[model samples]
Target: MKNTSALFIIDDVIANQLLELDDEYIGYQVLHEESFYKHLLDVQEFPVIDEYSNKESHKALLVIRSWQEVREILKEVQKEKNINAWKRLFPCQLYADGAYGEDTIIQNLSCAERLLIRAVQEQKYVMFYC
Candidate 1:
């Protein structure tokens, strides 16, 4: 469990279930670590973050967003096909500078980006949290 950041959109029933018994929650692979958090921050989509437990804080920090907002941000992020888009939303120091370093981050996230986009399009609550 190196990184705990989870970006997902789920139906209300699933959200409610997890709210009750989070032990059953299966983790999603973190697409981008710092950039994902920065993206949430840039969009002002903050919920309570549980800093102490770190990876285990997902249940405590659960937040729901309307699919419209999710769609808009996803659209903006999906454009660049590179970390340049993420860097534009975030800051310089968070990522290593150079094409190789940046592309490493961006290239691996294609599947995650697609899955998240699908979730958003389904009009579920898109979330970024534990």
Candidate 2:
């Protein structure tokens, strides 16, 4: 099976509600491949990683991250001079093939960045789930 992930920027209210739910679904979620975070984004750690026992969940692995950190990471990622690297990691066919029905890494990163901007303006946090 293909690995997929999603990023969400939400206020405390929604985050709390999602945590209370039975892992049904989440809203305002920008979907991407798992490598989007590891390769492109280069995220070394995820918030709330220590809060959960099961790192591998059949439902969804939820982790909350700071918007500031996300924005900073995006800023650094955008500084990458090699466009080919992005293309290599996020080939168009990845999304077109419908393996997980996700957007290209760049597309989802843009969406996630926009969400981070909104989160910063609204004083919120970015939540990640895989």
Which candidate leads the pack in lDDT?
1
TM-score of 1: 0.41
Worst 10 residues of 1 by lDDT: 41-50
Each prediction's Cα lDDT score?
Answer: 0.44, 0.42
Candidate 2 clashing pairs, residues 3+ apart or interchain: none
TM-score of each: 0.41, 0.38
Q: Which tens-of-lDDT digit does each residue in 103-126 have in candidate 1?
A: 545654554465456666666655
Q: For candidate 2, lDDT tens digit of each residue in 1-130?
A: 1123433433455455456766554332322334222223222222222222134444444566566765555454551353333333222333343433223444444544455566556555555554
Model 2 stretches astray by more than 4 angstroms: 1-58, 79-103
Q: Give the residue spans of candidate 1 off by over 4 A.
A: 1-64, 79-100
For every model shown, the clashing-pair count is 1, 0
Q: CA shift at 99, candidate 1, in angstroms?
A: 13
